[model samples]
Target: MYPIIRMVKQMILHRNDPPLSAMGTHVSHHRCWPWDIDLWMELNNGRTLTLLDLGRIPLAHRIGLISVMRQKRWSMTMAGVSVRYRRRIRTFEKFEMRSRAVYWDDRFIYLEQTMWKQDGECANHALYRSAITDRDGIVPPAQVIEAMGADNTRLQAPEWVQGWIDAEAKRPWPPMQD
Candidate 1:
């Protein structure tokens, strides 16, 4: 089951917190409950992505993206992701999650997120490509940025993120020989 209840709690708790810059980091904490573990006694890979939603949504709220999306009746969706799991996270272990938007191109926004154990070990990290959409279809990221009332100034996406974007572009959709 998804931790939607916990995610809502987080939203209410941080509702009044100060906002961050478009490229600023948002740090949030979470724990690995027994239910979060897989049969191998570690955090399930799917659960990790769901938990990442807690960090990314808060980051979006802090950066004013959520507000703009709401005001414009737009929605956000994850278009793609590439993740790496380095260390196992055991039950009841607390971890700090860090999320930030690194950059945006005309069509998509790129974000980087991580889970760091209390002992300072990085358990996992992921790069996400998100799209803002409306009834018409996918809204250009440039339009989303402009709507947020922030300058459209962009920094270079890290080499790795750019590489992933390139690789994803080469993949065929509705895959399988037709």
Candidate 2:
């Protein structure tokens, strides 16, 4: 688990791009293979933790982004996803995964993720959104409010992530909106 965490940290640090095959199919890699289905089964019951794993990458990216920007009020969620498996990824295969922050406003954060094979083929991609909330999951934090102030510069996000954040911001949160 520590090793996996370290690998995740390294991936976030380098902002490495996903790898792919010559034909553009994503391949799996040794370091990230543990994040796949087979290993996920060993580590979890394949129910709740599966969902958590799906959200982990984007959440990690969100955390990294907040850290880089030196902001503390931003929050995120794994609001939605769509994952397609082209082939079974084995443990020994070398692969790469990359995630980028899509966007953020006063309400939510959006992110995009992709995994690829050594030859630079796309394996999986997902867009996710989470509502921005305070640490206790109640009101929006003041820091975030300040960060989104009128005079502040908007943060640049990747193409895939932009739409998601925009959509999430427009969507109403039931509890907060009421």
Candidate 3:
């Protein structure tokens, strides 16, 4: 069993969250795979952003910030997602991703993320909701949530996100179908 003292220490030290861009370096490219374009198209379509492509930049930043602030390990499970694409982003283009915490409920954390092209134009943006879970899928103790102030009750979908979702729903499924 995990020690209570260690849990308390982690809660106190790692709970201070930071913006995702502050944690790691930007990524420029991934080798061409047959599905690369499809994946990019999906991100642009606003359904859900794949975690794999989120990369170490955003992940390291968010995890590091949360660890530093809460002093504990935060295991995350994706709950929901929404994304918008402002411009076409290709496979080899250099890009940057920025993310910040939007809110947290007793059992969930929400984050707003944006991806930008080398020219600094918005390529895509997303709202990601995640739940905190243990390796065995157990929820964290109440004391941990209270210590982190993870009691937000005012979460709402942003206006731009609604628009993006609508637009994506209307997009042709297969490019050739249009």
Among these predicted structures, which one has the highest TM-score? Answer: 1
The whole-model C-alpha lDDT of candidate 3 against the native structure comes to 0.49
lDDT of each: 0.91, 0.46, 0.49
Residue runs of model 2 more than 4 Å from their true location after superposition? 1-76, 135-178
Which digits, one per residue and each the tens of the lDDT, describe model 1 over residues 1-178? Answer: 8788999988988898898878889999899999999999889999999999999998999999988989999999999999999999999999999999888888899989999999999999999999999999899887888888888877787898888988998998979885
Each prediction's total of clashing residue pairs, residues at least 3 apart in sequence or on different chains, is: 0, 18, 11
Model 3 per-residue lDDT tens digits across residues 68-176: 3346555556666765567776644555655555554455455677667677797776676656665556354343345445442345545664554456568776666
> Could you give candidate 2's per-residue lDDT for residues 53-172 as a string of tens digits?
433443353344334233665455455654545544345465565554455555554445565667778656656554555567733323443453422344666654665555656977
| Order by lDDT, highest first | 1, 3, 2
Residue 20, candidate 2: Cα error in Å is 23
Q: Which of 2 and 3 is ahead in TM-score?
A: 3
**How far in Å is the alpha carbon of 112 misplaced in model 1?**
0.6
Name the lDDT of candidate 1.
Answer: 0.91
Ranking by TM-score: 1, 3, 2
